[model samples]
Target: MTLSSSDSASLPAERLGGLLQSASFHPQQTIALGISDLAEQAKEDRADKLGISCAEEVGSVYAAILGAIVHRDAGLAD
Candidate 1:
């Protein structure tokens, strides 16, 4: 499943994981690791407004989608 920017935001974490895992775009572990990195970034950036946990969840998803864009732009995936 190739992800496009328009629809990436709507994908659930599990679904995104499945797509990344099944496609083997880059490395599954690398993508998985982004969850924590993204969550931390989100918490740092949005915790004041959205609260810690909520911002983490939002940040994780946003980061994952952004990562996908990076991968695509880098020609890591078709």
Candidate 2:
């Protein structure tokens, strides 16, 4: 789930912060998978609310963002 600079560029700081906060409520291993699932759900919710078809793309971006956050929190990132 490592993201290139470009891949991470479009992630909103506020959204990432919200995900981080949500992840904090779970254990480390669970947080990783949970964030991914949460991101997918968020993507679907946003797409439905906005009448957009970009859920897949949004989910991918959020997955990368959340993965980076989880890896860093687990002290697995350099």
Candidate 3:
């Protein structure tokens, strides 16, 4: 799910999330320990990501995704 310089304004959040989910970054590892532990869904996946030490890349990846989502949702990317 790669995007070129153009046509990026139309990318959807859910679609992007699906792509990100397949990446090396993992949400559970980046999130705080207590919070990650409390999350019931994807707990095992999260733990696995943590075990693999993917936490460092998660925040930046999430922020970029959020920025894109916000831009599209607000019609500001145009």
Please write out the lDDT profile of model 2 over residues 36-64, one tens digit for every residue: 76689889988797765577679889999
Candidate maximizing lDDT: 1
User: Where is model 2 poorest over a 10-residue stretch in terms of lDDT?
Assistant: 1-10
Model 1 Cα lDDT, one tens digit per residue, 1-78: 245777558656776666567556555555555555566766877757667678789999999999999999999987
The runs of at least 3 residues in candidate 1 whose Cα sits more than 4 Å from the true structure, single-residue gaps closed, are 1-50
lDDT of 2 at 20: 55
Q: What is the lDDT of residue 39 in candidate 1?
A: 68
Winner by lDDT between candidate 3 and candidate 2: 2
lDDT of each: 0.70, 0.69, 0.58
lDDT of 2 at 66: 100
lDDT, residue 49, model 1: 65
Q: How far does residue 10 in candidate 3 sit from its true spot (Å)?
A: 57
Q: After superposition, how far is residue 19 of candidate 3 from its true place, in Å?
A: 51
TM-score, one value per model = 0.34, 0.32, 0.30
Q: What is the lDDT of residue 64 in candidate 3?
A: 94
Span of ten consecutive residues with least summed lDDT in model 3: 29-38
All candidates: CA RMSD (Å): 23.4, 24.5, 22.8
